[model samples]
Target chain A: MRLAAVLLFLATISAICHTDGYIEQVTQQIHLLRPRSGAAGYRLKDVDCLSWRLAVETNNVRNWKLVPEECEQYVGHYMLGKQYRKDCEIVAHSAIEYAKSLTLVGDGKDIWIFDIDETTLSNLPYYARSDVQFGALPYNDTKFNEWVAEGAAPPVPGSLRLYQTLLPLGFKIVFLTGTAERFKDIRISNLKAAGYYTWEQLILKGEADQGTSALVYKSKKRTELVDSGYRILGNLGDQWSDILGDNSGNRTFKVPDPMYYIS
Target chain B: MRLAAVLLFLATISAICHTDGYIEQVTQQIHLLRPRSGAAGYRLKDVDCLSWRLAVETNNVRNWKLVPEECEQYVGHYMLGKQYRKDCEIVAHSAIEYAKSLTLVGDGKDIWIFDIDETTLSNLPYYARSDVQFGALPYNDTKFNEWVAEGAAPPVPGSLRLYQTLLPLGFKIVFLTGTAERFKDIRISNLKAAGYYTWEQLILKGEADQGTSALVYKSKKRTELVDSGYRILGNLGDQWSDILGDNSGNRTFKVPDPMYYIS
Candidate 1:
């Protein structure tokens, strides 16, 4: 009976926690992460609100700067949760179902665009290591570049499934990555090693593409694809830039990546 | 050249719309549905903010009251959008993936709880009619009862898919609805007609259950399920009350319903 009483008390507290008004309050706090000034007298600098913003920003949603070092561990744990993986899998599965509904032209002009890093390949193992601090550590291009060159990064399971599923369905696949052009040969090798083989094209950023924003550069490539008569049926990426902008395919599926942000 | 200029202009607009801070502001406005007063000097009664809240409240998130009659058409159109369907599908697909990961205890005690109404059977057809009005129209029990008695509400495709998928995986299914017990016969018939055949139980609110808040009634029932030795692996529902409170199971998947919110 004592146990039952305790259980009842806990349940009551849990019920109160989830009230619609409470959730709304939390949601409002999440919104404080927006660039706008604080709401009248409410200070947006509240720690809890900032933490909530960090989580939201790291997820599929865009905006806010990189999470503070103090918040990195929390974000890292969140990313590693089963829930996060489930979210990604859900998006991928829905994308597949949508792909199945399309009436493919089968002219080999039906192409699916994929962003490589964090989309096709995951650097989770690298991030998981103690030496390489999770999201809190500023991005070191030299170290990251070395990791990419090693070609050991594993395929994100959801994306791997998507890649495998799209191939037999008569749609051409293409890799459009933001990695510098110099890593093209290594990237191809890494992709093949990671179970991705033979894309229609592997477009990388060249010297001429330097200084251009990711949104502009990727959109330009997609526009070129459209100009050349390729019907981009699907576009998959982690960042908003990868899927937004002009010439975005018929559908865009965003896979969650909270580890880092790219402009 | 002309086409390129047009695309550039559109792209610029898109980029501006997605900036981190701008999205946070939009997200904050959506949460103003809470009954609380506005933050500091920010008036919660602002018409534009209210309008925006009405639109979001009717889509994926939950908990705002019946929208104003003036916002009905806007919500109606939103419900009819392809994007809305896609978002629901994404959530359902993710739930299914999470379910697949659980190892059933095989005691016939492993159960999955599903909320009726928007979670399983969609009331869209009835709501879509011009005479019915969107969420803004006050809920008429007599008319809704008539619709239930007709046993024609279509099954939400995602929930139906989940229902079919779970049965084969050895999990017992149950319907735990807030619907009055008087409609049990019609509800059962409707479930069968809509392709959800067997379940461990169909629990409904009885006459004695009246005057109780939905959160309390639902939580008490779930507590009973737990006491009976059934391990609830997952609970899926459209309303927060369906998935919250006591014995919320190991996981809860919220299916979006921007229509009427039940307290």
Candidate 2:
């Protein structure tokens, strides 16, 4: 919504390609998500960030190492802007509608799988930092982990709403993530702080799963959940990897995340 | 690109919805695809059509009866505009990249499955007609069938490119459509008319599949192919039903189609 609006108003959008100097400027202007005062709204075309995002959401674009350098500003605005939240709300709306439609067993074993990052929590604070370039730069494991250590990421928009609704419907929430086990305590506090207080399990990638792809790692974890007699009634994630593998729930809902791809 | 722009230029877009009178107006303006002369471009938001479309593409929204009435123009602009073509191009790019990455056996049994409507053919001409409302109104099977009987649908943008590239890469092509078998001859003439001169199999829904869900019907057809010794290397479609069923290839690509939803 308003996010792409600022982009439309900006005349300098065509110069958005990444360069050291440009990246430096981009990092300094995390505030650029806002439009300049009195700028006329007019969308200019480049690589069509709208199309790029749709491609990413549909998994048509895979393993993209970085956002197209030219779409950095577009992605930044989108992630930080109104459209992202509205998109999340729509997803939550759909998920809730579908969840309500099911005649569930209502047993304790009926579980809902939720991916932690970008799905349950927003790392926007860290991603918008001067060094991070909103994921336009290559990922730094150390830097991201430091952000994880802070345990302060907010809940993703609309996610807590979905969670609150699902809980009353008797879904045992399973928090699944690719984050390493060492960060477990911090993640618990972060989830609580972000309004996600309890869950049946908070699964993290352990030593044995360290080298596996998110798809493989998640699939194995979901298999184990099913083995323990939990029926995966619904699964929701921002990454394709979260929803593509074995036992991907009775239905899967994909939350929008154009900032980074995980698979 | 230009499609949404014209929408931005018009001041009447917010009035779009499913009233009988509104439907009449909508139908009369099949040519509403054209933007009127000399107006300021300003995207006014209602129900956040962009978010709605994203939800549909990600399969978060499912079994929808018709396009949301309010989003008719937004969907129309997107489908007929540069965005739709660009989205298709990106899907083709991803599919081709994945196709080339494979070490194919060079045998004709290595096959690619394609869904017909909105994947292989553009029903835009019919869908855009005065009576159809670009899918804003409820679907009319008889009208749609009459349109199909003409065998005049065009190739979805980038489909031909993907097909041509795959043919050279030693992959057998399968044109799988939910269109009934009665239209087989006409569809063949239609596909060839649309530049798809060849395919290993042109599968149309037969009596056996009359009441089957697309997921079941397609899964059965694809299983038959695999049983016949074909390797489904890739599958592409505009519907989740086309790609979500059993034995759905090693990889899948979803082409964007906002006009209709097939469960």
Candidate 3:
């Protein structure tokens, strides 16, 4: 009976060791497999967050809903820090210097393209509201449309300076936006109120463009501008799709946007 | 006895279901954690490969060793296909066009910087050998140094054309390499044999640069060049460190390099 008991004790010890080994191995594997959350303090710890971020920013993935937890830090950084403002200022400064070196044709054909929303206008106030805070809720079109109709959004700080500089340099300034044509009057009022006084054209998506992706619609519009004998010298935007695609201008500058992504 | 048997059966079923649920949860987590390998056929599935590639290419992370498996696809893509050649040709074509548009000051100070290895010279033959295939072995400095001493690596395709184009355009061609200055004779011979007949300067790292990282060494060298009244209009290389840092020229173009990375 003592021998049996001794054997049982040995078996229990062996089982405990095996279980500990298994747990350690699994934990190590989990550590290896987990995606790095850059810098730390981020909630999401998977490649889904990274891939989605890159895809949306680069315009490789379009028109996808964002989970709240995934975008919290991005939104927080944009809304709460000076990083975004500094980035815009630096990009604008570079654009100014680059433009100064160019000898314009003096034919009014040299043009610069600007995008609305986060590029030329700020919408942080709307995004900061409790309903849309952290991007937790699905994007509500009606609410956003109402906000646009208010025509109260301010200018994106550095962009107005860039706009004013390009105008006197003999380059025609054009505003191209993904906002629907229905909001044209309100967008114009908002732009004018925000210190964007004059532009050659304000191009917006029409009913016919509703079915197509932003890339297709924007590329088509750019081609039209090219065909109209306009030389797109510089294109600036907060989204990759705004500066990419056909006839994407001579030089494209991307302004940083982390609060929300547009397709 | 019947009640005990029933209870035992229920417990077994519950354990099996629990095990299955645990497995399903783990698999889902794994899927979320895995990095998208881009375009397909890549073997590495973890985020380490993706982050490392981005960090190295963007000059965010430097002076790091690469695991063999993570770099296998990069090596394979470089050695087995014409993708690398095509990318070089396209970049060179754009550079040619950009240079053609410029009206040079004709001061003999307009300079174009070229990196030597993988930028101007191809080392495919050495990398294709069985002993060092797939970067499976740790980097052998002695073997690589011997290969450099051979004076046999061919000129990188399209780079030769670019070099020829720039020479006649009144742009001073400068070769900046991280290779030690001790191999100056062999490197010059290699360049001469590979159709790079003349260059304004061939700057190689010296003993004083040995202790510094590539970025510091290269950036310091570039500052010296700039202080000498040289106008660096265009700089081209296969590494991010080559085109980044102090006095890194006006326009920098990156040629593709998937085989290996240098700090």
Chain A TM per prediction: 0.78, 0.83, 0.76
Please, what are the lDDT tens digits per residue for candidate 2 over residues A1-263?
57556555443544333332222221211112211221121122466787878888998777565676568778889888899999998888778877777777877998999998888999899988867878776566678888889999999998899999999998899999988888889999999999998899999888787766778889999999999999999999989889998999988999998877666
Top of the candidates by DockQ: 2
Give the Cα error of residue B138 in candidate 2, in Å. Answer: 1.6
Clashing residue pairs in all predictions, respectively, total 4, 2, 0
- In the range B1-263, model 1's lDDT, one tens digit per residue, is 58557556645643211111111121111111222221111112222322233223222122344453335555677668754465456456556666776888898999999998888998888888654665444445567677778999988857899899999999999899878887889899999999999999999888777756667888999999999999989888876677767888777766656666554
Off by more than 4 A, model 1: A1-63, B1-263
Residue B12 of candidate 1: its Cα lDDT? 65
Which prediction has the highest TM-score against the true structure?
A: 2
Better of 2 and 3 by DockQ: 2
Task: Kindly report the docking quality category of candidate 1.
Answer: incorrect
Query: Over the stretch A1-263, how does candidate 1's per-residue lDDT look in tens digits?
Result: 58557547645643211111111121111001122221111112223422243223222123334453335556667567664565556556656766776889899999999998878988887777554545444344567677887989888857888889899999899899888888888889999999998789999988787756677889999999999999999999877678867888877776766565555
Q: Report the Cα RMSD per candidate.
A: 23.9, 10.2, 24.3
- The digit string of per-residue lDDT tens for model 3 on A1-263 reads 58557547645643211111111111111001111111111222332443334333333233233433434555555555665565566567556756666889989889999988778998777867766653444445678778889999998867899998998989898898888888899999999999999988899988787656556778999899999999999988877667767888877777766554444
lDDT by residue for model 2 (B7-86), tens: 56442544333543222222211111111211121122356888888888898877565566467778878877888899
The CA lDDT at B57 in model 1 is: 27
Q: What lDDT is obtained when candidate 2 is compared to the true structure? A: 0.78
